[model samples]
Target: MRRAAVGSCPASKRSTLSLDDHAVGVGRARAQVSDVGRQDDPNARVGLHVDFWTVDDPDEARRLLAMGADGIMTEQLRRVATRGAIVAAMVRLTRRRFTVGAVAMASGACGGARAGEPWSEEPPPSRVDPGFMPAPPAPPSPDPRLAFAPVARDAAPPRSIWSWTTAEQATEIRRDEVLFTRESSPTLGRGHLFDVLDARAADGDPAAARLAGVELAKGRFGWSNPWATVRGATPGETYGLELLHIEMRPDTWFARVRTSHEAIAFVDSAGNAVDRGAALDSFERVGGILFEHDVEYTGACATTGSGGGGLIYREIYVGNEARLATFSHRTAAILARLEGDIAELSAFRDWLRYGGGDGWSAYSWSCIAAQLWRSAPSTSRERYLASLAFATDPYAPYAASVDAIVTELKKASFFTPDDPFTHAP
Candidate 1:
């Protein structure tokens, strides 16, 4: 079962908090930082829906403390935390909240019902008459099909079609195969990424504009919408979308759509977004399509350092790798679905690589920076490799959270190469 995280606030720049109708009893005392948001709020769960998570080192964010944000998700928090004493104080206060919770729980020991503690005054029970109720009927025989009764050693063959695909058989088959996808995996947290995607797209409909609900509009392009922000993920509640494959051409600028996750592919001529082995329902759930992100010999992205359009992931639009941009014309955005999972990052990268129609030189693994491999952290580091392993086979061992991925990585006994932002490389 999924549980929401809640905690107190680190001594945030009280000024940054907005005491709306939702937050009663929270008082004001001429707070300091006006843009703190919930980054320093101890009560804010790390995976709860956020308006936005900014990455640009703006002077506006003077300082902050991280709460439940996974390591990959808390880069913003660390950036603000490094800002001298005031921010350090905030971090300290935030970490201290856990201690406070522990202390409170410890103190609660004395308030519980103990063996020696006296009970409240009890009342006496009333007398009852006989012959008031009837007895229950005899139990019925259990059905062998649905019941947990053992199979007879000499029993005849089962009748149901499912007998051919029993749980044990299914597990063995999947173990033998190297690849398989299921409806079980979910996009992190947000059930529908399309909901966020809608907020990010620029639509003319008055109803859509009203529903988009923006405090500040960024042209017709919903590029800068906070809700659709690009960042590491948390588990999504509903399995909103499933991207099977994208169609792209390696030779010419001209392209066609057909489907296959096996190689670079796209939708078919008949408008069928079908894959050989992928379920059609999952394919239709794709809120959008994905592309590849391969390069060789220092491409434009490596050269110019531009953030190609997509936020939340390998930004390529306004950077050196200008070719990393995506579009709805050649590409498709999944609507009303969440496709979040560290494991799925590879697919997204593939989508980026091929969808943008940049002439590929060669498939160079080194081009994919080490940082791209960094998984979501458990305690200190994220489990990027574990996620990739999960991506290879999400059904193999099941992923619980970012922590689960991290634990898997730890079990694999591999080293995580560090990527320092030295001189903004």
Candidate 2:
């Protein structure tokens, strides 16, 4: 179990040196190997096993081996091991065939010559044993899942969303448009539309699943069906309702459907769906209520000295205005609907306060407090305070905008010291 070490050789040398006398080993860096040199056959230098260090690239390892490296030290151990296994398998297969061929040749030569006589120019004829016939090659196994049934080109198959219109070649352009793009037939109604979409979704159609989820969340058909559909949905198909606040549990599906009325730019940051006008309207409606003073915008909010004094009044219509407006309008709409539902409100508040663990989640919570005061000033104020008290930890990251809204609301005359809303669980 002797250990070998790697050391550098002199710049003038053109080959690797093994210093067994000093009990030292020498190796080269990639650059050093090219400069101080490489041997055409480093293995020919007896008592030496050339090893390269820190090799991670597959091509670089192959190049080093071609240049006579006996082994390599790599951080990517799994990759190297996998390659070695593949090479070993190929060698084993070749060796088995080589052994068989060698035995066949030996048998022929043994039968041809006598012990003292010279060998004949032509080889002895091979005799087949009457009782020993080689078995014929095995027939290929057919796959049970596949069948090849040919159909006539002119035949029309049964109508389906998954299959093309023709049995063979497509005869008309957009032949399947009626199945997907067109409105449901007058006799079928909207339920049929959803049925088709749901069928497609269950069969692993992402686009159909997404569309069905979005439409179901919209609740145009009614609340009962959407709730039932989403409740029964498997993880494989969330029906585009993956953004629902999970902390709400059994009712989270309904919350997701309820909140769909307000457009939430869940993934995008460009504020493409943000309505700046609606946000300004919300701010105008609730500014005086939250601040408890005349709401007027001064340039002070943009400066560090403004502190928490100006708060929502100065910031709402300033930097990231569209985002603020969008958040205000969307959250306020959703919160307004949950006014009397204390259990749902608490769950929603928990999601807003604690879900900012990642960049996208943090951004989603940034303006969650926006326009909330405008929904129902007194109720909103109490709800906001209750949410703050419910938090076991500090507010999540990117919650400064939400904090500004809370700060402004604290100045109201109705602001209370104790929790405004309470429930057992």
Candidate 3:
């Protein structure tokens, strides 16, 4: 004779399936299954199947299956049978005034009963029983700070695939920037190299714009007035310079060229200049230019700067060896950032479309944003800005909120989980 016990208790507190070779019983208590009673048990007393009872939630059923349960007994046949339709419908409902919690309850109850509670003869509450649960309050209005304002199509182009910078590429870029800044002079004559490059940049030469932007950012060739230098330059030039200024050393040269819009210096929470990854920022900005221009360069093999005196003229034809290296390195970094941003955005969008309707998706988004705010607020801001530029309609609100929150976060010197600015909500 084989024995089994079927019981109900808080799923978190106790198991619902128990079996042995003796007698069968059902009650609200902790389950005890012997190895011999399990079908998979090597020393088997009986070939017993482990099944859970009264599982109304499809999510719970899935969880049980993962835990090696043989079968599940769920009352709501339609919900379990039409899981896809229910989830899709819930997504539609979430767009309305109904709270995510309400939709979750309408699908299925998460737990069987409270711990130590006795089973009652009364029937289980109806899955959609309005009488069992009060009407959920309407969702709060969108935060004023996160209010969506559509940017121009030209300004925020559709998302595109991008690759990450490799270690070798990064090393090459750093080497180039350092060597170029040391060896090359931005002067061709009294007029300066920028005078010609600036005109070329205006004429839509991405390479020229990039070179000129880097020189202007470094305050080379007697370049003063950051805004004035870039005033007539291309959009790529302006953005590239802005990125450079954000991480450039704040010295006499930087001071002479820094715009009012640019930060005096990027610093950590302790007010110390963040120098550890500063070089990477420079590289990334340069990379952005290359990506915008859709240009490619081979690594160190691409340029020969050591040949002879004709090197200066060769640079004018191509680009400064150092500048070219930095360009390639930074381009790789920009591609990496884009790749990460796209992956995160895709996952977020999927969550919005097919996430559990128990408000966990929204909660997780807030948590991730908060974590990024604490660890890398600037990165968070840049990511959101990218998201705003690239995200589709379904996820625009989330991106906008994060963008707004970054502004608030920038005002604070330190961060805590409880900080109001840490989360978009």
List candidate 2 segments past 4 Å from native: 1-341, 352-354, 357-425
- Candidate 3 per-residue lDDT over residues 124-173, each given as its tens digit: 33423332233333343332222122222122111121112224433443
Look at candidate 2 and tell me the lDDT of residue 129: 24
Q: Provide the lowest-lDDT 10-residue window in model 1.
A: 98-107
lDDT at 179 for candidate 3?
A: 19
lDDT of 3: 0.25
Those runs of model 3 whose alpha carbons end farther than 4 Å from true positions after fitting are 1-93, 96-132, 139-396, 399-425
lDDT of 1 by residue, 187-274 (tens): 2322232243354345443322322233112111111111111112222221112111111121111111111112322233233444
Candidate 1 segments whose C-alpha is farther than 4 A from its true place: 1-184, 188-308, 311-408, 411-425
lDDT of 1 at 140: 23
Give per-residue CA lDDT, model 2, range 30-140, as digits (tens). Answer: 211111122232211111112223233456445545634322221011111110011100001101110001001111111111222222222233422222222322232
TM-score of each model, in listed order: 0.18, 0.13, 0.23
Worst 10 residues of 2 by lDDT: 82-91
Whole-structure CA lDDT of model 2 = 0.22
**Global CA lDDT of candidate 1, please?**
0.21
Highest lDDT model number: 3
